[model samples]
Target: AQSVSQHNHHVILSEAASLELGCNYSYGGTVNLFWYVQYPGQHLQLLLKYFSGDPLVKGIKGFEAEFIKSKFSFNLRKPSVQWSDTAEYFCAVIYSSASKIIFGSGTRLSIRP
Candidate 1:
């Protein structure tokens, strides 16, 4: 029953607007979490991560997330986004070496200028 799912498949925003995309997983063990963003024709970059320690973590481009162990979720949030933030957001889980990293279907975020 180890699976992760994204609720938001696509999102659109203006010049400055709040953003909140949901990510839920079904793992019952200690695991690493990550959020990756891929720009148009660009490779995937680490946005943030929750390996151990703190439950709240931040990353590049003014993005942050809070890990809720009870809910098995690591939802991403951003206050006031920009046009450059327009890209595909993916939520991934770090599993054992045998299992490759898995990415959500992706949330296409389009920013209107």
Candidate 2:
């Protein structure tokens, strides 16, 4: 079965630290990748997405992800993170062959003020 994997279960960093969360999916056919962030007491929101065209897509809040077809990876990165960036990040994929979206367990990001 196709699935998404988030390498980091939990990540802790001080303010202004660079952040990189690894995400990889197992799918052979065409797929769409997305990164979602859920803040404390809030619903999940779209952070960034890669559907077509450019492999690198930028989203809200200075977050970006690269869709590497060869590696089956869509890793999220931010140059510097702030305390407000603390949230749970999820990697999701939608395979063309399937109608449902598959999501990774998610990575919890805790930023130290």
Candidate 3:
């Protein structure tokens, strides 16, 4: 079974501050990683994903993630965050042999204006 872990349960930052959320998985096989964000009243939206090809993947809303195979990590990052970016971020993984997506505990990002 595969599982995702998000070290930070809550994060606070001011507007324009850099953001980096930690995300790691426990799978060693072929897998796909994804970063999803859920706003205060909206559904989950795909931020970014890494399936194959380039290790660095750019996602919506100026977000990006790098697939580090050796470390089993797919950390999400953004150079500058905005108040609108405030949301609950989730790290997910889907193994090639599995049909379900394993999601992390989730990290709540709070941005101050």
Candidate 4:
């Protein structure tokens, strides 16, 4: 079985500040990794994904993440964040043969404008 963990359950940031969120997964087989973000009262959207190829992947809203196979980590990063970045972020993982996914509890980011 696969599992996902997010280091922080809540993150507070100031507008225009840099942001980084840690995500890690545990699985024995090949896996698909994703970071989903939900804005205030909005639905979730894909921040990034890692299925194959390059270890480092980029996502929307100036966000990026690096997939480290050895570390089993995919950390989300943004050079600068906006007040609009305030949202709940989730880390999810799916294995090649798994029918379902494992998601982190979620990280609520509050951006102080």
Cα RMSD for predicted model 2: 0.6
Model 4's TM-score against the true structure: 0.94
lDDT of 2 at 82: 99
Candidate 1 has an lDDT of: 0.88
Q: Report the C-alpha lDDT of model 1 over 3-112, residue by residue, as the tens digit.
A: 77998888999978999889987775777889999999999999999899999999888999989999989999999899999999999887654266777788899999
TM-scores, one per candidate? 0.92, 0.98, 0.97, 0.94
For model 4, residues 20-53, the per-residue Cα lDDT tens digits are: 8999888567999999999887888998998999
Model 2, range 1-113, lDDT digits (tens) per residue? 89999999999999999999999999659999999999999999999888899999999999999999999999999999999999999999999999999999999999999
Worst 10 residues of 2 by lDDT: 24-33
Which 10 residues in a row give candidate 1 its minimum summed lDDT?
94-103
**Which runs in model 3 stand beyond 4 Å of their true positions?**
none
- The ten-residue window of minimal lDDT in model 3 covers 24-33
Which one wins on TM-score? 2
Clashes of 4: 0
Tell me the deviation in Å of residue 18 in model 3. Answer: 0.5
Better of 3 and 4 by lDDT: 3
What's each prediction's clash count?
Answer: 0, 0, 0, 0
